[model samples]
Target chain A: MLSIPIEYYLILSAFMFIVGVTGVLIRRNAIVVFMCIELMLNAANLSLVAFSSYHGNPVGQIFVFFVMTVAAAEATVGLAIIIAIFRNKLTVNVDEINIFKW
Target chain B: MNIELILFIILATIAAVTSILVITRSNAVISAVFLVLNFFALAGLYLLLNAQFISVVQIIVYAGAIMVLFLFVIMLLRTDGEPRIFSDKRYIKYFALLISIFVFIQVSYLLLIGSPSKSVTGNQSASINSGTIETIGKELYTNYIIPFEVAGFLLLAATIGAIILAKKKFE
Candidate 1:
């Protein structure tokens, strides 16, 4: 149904992945960084869906299913870790929480 | 010219803009809100690509469950008092922006110029029904049964791990 080139979707997702990387590198807030990671995942999922549709492969959709599962799990554990860290450090700023920074 | 193209353009734009906003916003709440918008836009894009099941799952899992979890965590942590935004070490922002722009240009050049006429001709009938719930469910039940079970176990493990990690006093 889509006549638009796959490159367009790939490029858009590429832009998104870059933005996520930029956010991860520069953002001080750890929560914001996690959100950036989600953005990157979303971008990857987009490209995967695009390729899947173009090739008419249900395998790609299956992989996307697995990805969604992993993402959900990752978010839960990651956020819980963040909460625990915040409890101990009283801050979510990456710059400040440097107990392991030697 | 076509309605589908127009919809794709609009959704892509929304996805792009909302993602940028999610990253740039200093306030975590605002970022969470924007991320929801981004997810909705992505769901639209998936719908365009004939990923009917994925689009629904994206909305239910990512937008519905995951984002609500994010919002809950953000509210729980409450990091608003700390001077929101580029107060110290501002150079990191510039450096990151420079690197991201460089990477984006490289990728765009590769995708737009390096690749020539990349297209996939697939079984039209297969593709038409590939996105339907029936096909995905069948695949999940048959060929992907092992992986599906593994995912369930992984989720169970994650739930236990999260509970353990977030406990008030773990000895």
Candidate 2:
């Protein structure tokens, strides 16, 4: 067995996903949290590629490409929304962004 | 332990730690920069997994394009310094902490309780070592035509949506 099992990569991805989740939850800054979400997405991508490699399949690798493209689009839209929020409230705190909060 | 295994562990730890820093740090710019570092480490992990195309694209799209745009917007907005972001929401910090712990537990359980046996040989590909960008390009345009087109359409919509949202206030 390779010292690093495929499971190891899976575990690493899981840890990263947890960390990203924590970052999203703990950070009040919208940008920080936004980056955290990106972190989570990348974690998922890492596992997908790792699993694909372990399986010796090209499908998962291709899926990673799709995920990357979507991530790019999501980041663009998300950052633009952040910009709009900044314009309206002059702040990027999720708490202060109570314009629509019920 | 093999070199790849050791390197993965070290890099994974670094990525996780820096990601924590990226979120906990008060400075928005610093957080953004750390996110870039996190992406680079992820790309490195992708490299170790033998997903050369994914790794290159990870760097190009994430570390290069997306992160630069994020930094640009953050800097352009001038919201780097603290100016009363979540000062009033005192409970939010605790709430976030709880959520993170919950997620960690959930994922740990799923991993532990799920299948421990590794599958033998369902993933062997004839073109693994030899297939390059040329093959990927051909496959993307051929067998993966529908999903590829759908992804392109999604990008177009996201682009239009972003432009509309960003330009709405001015008009």
| Model 1 clashes, total count | 0
lDDT of 2 by residue, A1-102 (tens): 223566667777888888888777666678777788888888898878776776666777788789888988999899889988888888887878997768
lDDT of 1 by residue, B1-171 (tens): 899789988998999999888877778899999999999999999998888999999999999999999999999886964354566457777888899999999999988885523655434566668888899999999999999999999999999999999999789
- DockQ category of candidate 1: medium
**True lDDT of residue B93, candidate 1:** 76
Per-candidate DockQ versus the true complex? 0.74, 0.57
lDDT of 2 by residue, B57-93 (tens): 8889999999898888878876656534356367776
TM-score, chain B, each candidate: 0.91, 0.81
Task: Give candidate 1 regions above 4 Å deviation.
Answer: B81-89, B121-124
The docking quality of candidate 2, as DockQ, is 0.57
**Interface root-mean-square deviation, each candidate:** 1.6, 2.9
Mark the 10 consecutive residues where model 2 chain B has the least summed lDDT: B122-131
Backbone clashes per model, in order? 0, 2
lDDT of 2 at B132: 47
In candidate 1, how many Å is residue B142 off?
A: 1.0
